[model samples]
Target chain A: MTATVIDGRMVARGVREETARRAAALTTAPVLATVLVGDDPASGVYVANKRRSAAAAGIGDVHRHLPGTASEAEVAAVLDELAADDRVTGILLQLPLPGHLDPARLVERIPPEKDVDGLTTRSQGLLARGEPGLRPCTPAGVIALLDAAGIGLAGRRAVVVGRSTLVGRPMAQLLLGRDATVTIAHSRTRDLPALTRSADVLVAAAGVPGIITGAHVAPGATVVDVGIHRTSDGLVGDVDRAGVAPVAGAITPVPGGVGPMTIAMLLANTVAAAQTREAAR
Target chain B: MTATVIDGRMVARGVREETARRAAALTTAPVLATVLVGDDPASGVYVANKRRSAAAAGIGDVHRHLPGTASEAEVAAVLDELAADDRVTGILLQLPLPGHLDPARLVERIPPEKDVDGLTTRSQGLLARGEPGLRPCTPAGVIALLDAAGIGLAGRRAVVVGRSTLVGRPMAQLLLGRDATVTIAHSRTRDLPALTRSADVLVAAAGVPGIITGAHVAPGATVVDVGIHRTSDGLVGDVDRAGVAPVAGAITPVPGGVGPMTIAMLLANTVAAAQTREAAR
Candidate 1:
């Protein structure tokens, strides 16, 4: 374990403290509207964590939980109400909705200013245009982690595995925004190892557990694992930690790395929305 | 000169013919509202060509020419009028407005539904999300050229030089959408030749004449030159045509390449916008 573990928990704590300080200075307290459509146990836990973190950061949390069989219209109605609410500074729509619900339509209902999760087309569009707006939490968190580690992205070769709109795509855009020569590789990419080996900064986000090994990593490259899978033993990431740690320069741990940073970024976005709304007013 | 030249003019003719057929079949005649805010000779020529192309494609062209001293507010007013016009199927705002005007604000004035250039935030957002919308002209033209050449983009290593929103960024996104391992290299990127040499498909869009030579290109790679520089020695492209022809499997020329295809895609977008508007009605 010669590689330095990027301590996301420590950095996340710093983020929350700074967010709390900023929230206290605001003339109006920020309120986050959280909508959970189904009773997926994992989603429930995730929502609960966010609420708890919001409170700890001195922000108000407004939770709306619908039945598991809720229709898309029903969910959209909730989003519309939240969007029009003057008290709500940001909105978080818990993912993995019931099978029948159209998540895209529901996400579109949240206005770009209040979209804390940054999943709406407008937020993605703003990002694509390199405009200042609420960015996706996980990818933004990765940026914070890299900054915390004092890693420079400019002119570096960044290779991202995965192309999900939620993570990989936005991640690549963020890297590109910072002037990194970015390459996005997916399941269809040929000679994956050769591509990975060429990266100065490698981001593993394939969601498949233990998909990246030492052979797939470049020597002295910084690896940020964005995938997390929980099994009976414990939580694991997309990268083979034991195999990659010896070969990599820096690696993030599964439980404490990107996971904590995501919650922190959500809080940061909520505060930012509050500030932006206040300024606009 | 073993490389096959990608014939843009012939392909553009095919495209215009198809668009004319589609326009003729429409219940209502498609009308394009073009706003030219400056007296720049190049812009004037570009706008004139666009109108001529629109007529050839059986689409009505409505030209609104403003003086060089026109205010941003005035240009925006014209866009607003076009946006509300029931007969207007698509809106085109010519580039390089007056010195006092902010082009971004004026461009945003055109409603997303009628933004034929695909430069609006909403249109860009839709593309970033991989949703169906009017795409940028030049990048869409590049995709059309590739399809016409019987080149498969999926699983290929595609390298794009330059990161201008007009060409490189959107081009990378289009390639990525087609399952290609996409890389974006800009002026700030390190080791340009090494990076370009690794690509299966190379797109030169830096707007610099003769920036990419044979040594910078991978042998047998398909090269698309988006830059068109008018020099004393006639027109040239970003890729060194004479130097790269022997190395590349296929290449596009400066005069007959991307230049013709851009107007073709614009006509295609106008027809597509008309189809979408009619469907909504």
Candidate 2:
């Protein structure tokens, strides 16, 4: 009675390889400039993985190292430098800076064209307007995985759990654009279990592990887990891996689910950045 | 125990009169350039009403009347003309244009500064970013009504019963900015009543009449009805007026509740637009 497991690692590899091929075809080698701030171990791990993935994806000009503990002005300066650099097609600033920094204000300084992370207000505006542009990688990955699964979106009842600006909001927006009747359910939502029971597709992005259990899921629904948490026990997502998998039609696993896809999409976004040189011109 | 009724017509008159005073004070009256395309009777009535309201607010330089059969290029041309107009502080393209026309696209053509209706992507972005800027009238009016009523939003549960860009989405964003634990419910939402019943403040913006009934409302919760539908009996709202009023602590009447607030906010936005000029100087 177990549901199909969504193999995100393999899917992400395919996506990265595809991006590599496309990137190699481009006249100029795509580059990603990542500006890191403060010594957050998680941010360090993420940035390292991204640089490695970029190189593996044939984005050969990737800048692998940036100083940790860099001030807001310094980080913005690095972004400005990269923005002007011909080699760098995309710029991503590792987030949750020191106490004194205004992260959103610094983010606004990144030119929209180089905003691969899609956290910029302008990029969000573009997404809300349903225009083609660089999208938030996590949400973009969710859609890519769903599209890869060949799931029909029309008239489907999709309940997205979480409403953060980064992932949940944009995911609901993308789902809406694909014509799935989408509703965003957040932490404050009452009877969350009851709501999940009615969903044809459930997207768990709340960052709360084991929030959606077996009893909560509708029978035969595709579930995409966008949450990745590391506990003393192990890697887990917002959805209970064992509990909901049996009832769900297909489900994405935790460590392998959205994590790898995040890097792959970042590479894809770089290729997209380079392609804009032609598509927009 | 009947809930206190919030009067909107009276509030709207206050807003309109304030606008009139400012308009009268201006050496050269501010103009509201209204562009309408394709003769939809409802749209015609709406635009004419806006013109009368503009005049009543002492805003004399109202450039009313636009072609119904205007081409996209022609409409854009009008928008461009308005954008260049020094006297026009507010430019609004009346909604639901002809089949071939894109209302969203036309809304973009209005200069962001002159986008008095606050439907442009830029304005929406400003709202999303929690920046100082113009806002959508209906949603802005709802917030203003709460403020006017001396309602405190801190640590409150705000339920916005809709998800459209113009009202529901922005309303939720506004409430989030105000520290309300916000939830957005819609047609696809399961057990919508259970969700609404927990709200300290309930906003009905779904445009469906008699949707939020007595059973759906929380006892002593402030109810702000955003829906205004013409029923066979008369004007109606998403909240079941008669049924929910007695159970609610504060209720906004249909004709007098959100309607006047909309016009008042529109006038308020115009004043804000004028103030921006001085700030720029």
Using TM-score as the measure, which candidate wins? 1
Of candidate 1 chain A, the 10-residue stretch with the lowest lDDT total is: A69-78
What TM value does model 2 have?
Answer: 0.75
lDDT of 2 by residue, B151-266 (tens): 88866778888878888888877886676756667776667787788788999988888899999999999999988889798888888989998899999988789987876787
- Model 1 CAPRI rating: high
- With candidate 1 superimposed using the best TM-score fit, by how many Å does residue A6's alpha carbon deviate from the native? 0.6
lDDT of 2 by residue, A1-281 (tens): 88888888888989988999999988878888887776789888888888888888888654534455556678777777888887788988888777678888888887888889988877877776567778999999998888888877766778888878889888877886776656567766667787777688899989898888998899999988988788998888888888987899999998888778888998899889988874655
| Candidate 1 pairs with clashing backbones | none
lDDT of 1 by residue, B1-281 (tens): 47999999988989999999999999998999888886899999999999999998899989999988887778878888899999999999999777899988888888888989999988888898888999999999999999998888999999999998888999999999899999999999999999999988999999899999999988889999999989999999998999999999999988999899999999999999999888888
Query: All models: lDDT?
Result: 0.93, 0.81
Q: What is the lDDT of residue A183 in candidate 2?
A: 57
Off by over 4 Å in 2: A25-29, A38-41, A60-74, A84-87, A150-152, A219-221, A246-249, B1-7, B14-114, B129-132, B142-258, B273-281
Against the true two-chain complex, what DockQ does each candidate achieve?
0.88, 0.23
